[model samples]
Target: MNMRNLIVFSLLSLFMGLFLVLAFSLAGSGGVPQSMGVNNSFGEIKIKRMVAPDFSLDLYDDREIRLSELRGNVVVLDFWSSWCSPCRKEAAVLAEVYLEYRDKGVVFLGISIWDRDEDALAHIEEFDVQYPSGPDSKGEILVEYGVTGIPEKVFIDQRGNKVRKFTGPSTKDELVAILDDMLGSGY
Candidate 1:
């Protein structure tokens, strides 16, 4: 074979080898399966309700909020980060939906994980989010919620039980359906 053809083949072989190594490394580290589990459920609910673990957060507004205090109100816990593209995509939908349900016995709370406070607060402002938001600085909240990635959501019923978890970006309709169900509405 010509020297030019030989060189091309060698380069391609090296690139393929490197790609395989990277892929295998990620898979071996359990990253592949974890990422693959970021389920987007739309409005479907299939999980049985479990009592939500309580948590306290210092909101961006310098106020403290405890999950237990929100009893008797439906809660939506949005787990997101500014660096996550899917989170950014759903920010507007969350903000708009929160407004619609704010006075309907629904409470929307944002938990920013794996992001700087500045970035998280900036994203909140950029999205014009009126809901209370706070940073999960130590990731305790994330661990408790079994969140493996950003853009996950946990819905709580009026009795403070975790009703469902949506693992990726959600739409306005999806949020509405869940909220309606939690509120005992016929929607």
Candidate 2:
């Protein structure tokens, strides 16, 4: 090959190598696959009463549970992580609400995503959370639930229909109001 052509080929190879390294690093970090389209913002997304997707995951205690099995009770599926500051702030509030309404037939499930299992478990324990929680293995459930960010809460009614979603840190009052609405709807 000519000198100029040789130099261009070498540069192209270097760029390709760099791209591969970056791609693999991202994949290793529990990053969602690009085709999943999970990075889309939820700003305009509104929760509607629709059939909740069936998902089964392993809890931190090593037991497998399915969302479908949690029917007949209001389910609060929270997508959060140890690294998310907002999640740390919201965990206590969620715990308090869970304790208050758990006897009233409410089930809270914390789905930790894109984080180490140990860290997730530690955060749950640190916050004194009394909810069924598990890691979203490979982010598959997060993609399915359209979770674009941390601290997202999806509320499902007694009939297993997704009724509402809160995308950020929510106050206790806000959670109470949401619960009241869901209960009033008689779903």
Candidate 3:
């Protein structure tokens, strides 16, 4: 190869190697994949009961769950990762809420983005999470929902409307209040 051609080839190989390292690093970080287009800005809210985008995902327990199939029931989609500290805190609260309202016609599904299956599984077991959760292997749901960070939550009502959303970790009381209103627990 000519001197100029050799230099270009070497540079190209260096960039490719860097890209692979970054991809693999991110794949292990338990955060959302950067290619999925993050939108972590729920601070400037223009909330509405828009249709919750539908998706089908494979759960760790060998079950396939579909958002559209969950109509007529309240659905709470939690975007989280094992490596995130806040997500670890949220897991306990989520399990508490899930235990309380699961039988009351509410479904809580955890979507693990930018994560490996074993790490996600370890997180679930560590937190004693009783809810169904799994890896979003291709980040399809994250991109669809505009998720930009760990521990983000999207609440869908019985009619499949994306009625509300919460970014960051939420407390048990906060989640309970929302569920109570959605399910009309007292009425």
Candidate 4:
């Protein structure tokens, strides 16, 4: 081949090799492939890029509850342990918000992590939590959600998308504001 043709062929080969490397990297990362059609509901759901891992736990009442089952309503998943002081302080605020918004289709599920069921139940009783509370028994929820501390709150939109996350104690006003926004969206 002439020099010009050789140069052109080399450039084309280089471009093709780069494209294949990028494609392989993307495929190995397990990201949504561009070839596969994107789900339109993902955009409508509001939580982009972050997938909420599903889990099931036993409630204090001995009933099994699955996070995926509450997909039609906004959910607040509070991760707490009875030994956490900040969690103790935040329990009442959570309860208040639950009471105010439960009728409006908002659900709060308190999942205790790294604590005994009896102690968690005692704290719930002490804080007067009327909503369903449960034990994370195997720490699966903590690991799935990447929780490194106690009293982490995750807000899931009506479409089962995780829209927001908060670590530490949340005031009543903050909780109320979030609920207001979620309710305003007609969820």
Give residue 146's error in model 4 in angstroms: 0.8
> How many residue pairs clash in model 4?
0
Per-candidate local distance difference test: 0.83, 0.83, 0.82, 0.78
Order of candidates by lDDT, top first?
1, 2, 3, 4
Compose the digit string of candidate 3's lDDT tens values, residues 1-187.
9999999999999999999987886684455454332334433234676898888989999999999999988999998887676777778889888999989999999999877788889998988888888889987888888777767888888989887888778888888888999898332
Given candidate 1, what's the lDDT at residue 108?
A: 91
Q: Summarize candidate 2's per-residue lDDT along 73-136 as a digit string, tens digits.
A: 8899989887777778889999999999998878999998877888888998999998989998
Q: Give the better candidate number (1 or 4) by TM-score.
A: 1
Give the Å shift of residue 171 in candidate 1: 1.0
Clashing pairs in 4: none
Report the poorest 10 consecutive residues by lDDT, candidate 4.
Answer: 36-45
Segments of candidate 3 deviating more than 4 angstroms: 1-45, 185-187
Off by over 4 Å in 2: 1-44
Instruction: Tally clashes: model 1.
Output: 0
* Residue range 1-187, candidate 1, lDDT tens digits: 9999999999999999999977876675333323333345443345677899999999999999999999989899998877677888999999999999999999999998877777788999999999999988898999998887768888888888887888778888878877777788432
- Name the runs in model 4 displaced over 4 angstroms: 1-49
Tens digit per residue, CA lDDT, model 4, 1-187:
9999999999999999999978885684344233222111211122343557888889999899998898878899988777677787788889888998998889999888777677788998999999888987777788888776767888888888788877778898888888789878843
- Clashing pairs counted in every model: 0, 0, 0, 0
**What is the TM-score (0 to 1) of candidate 1?**
0.75
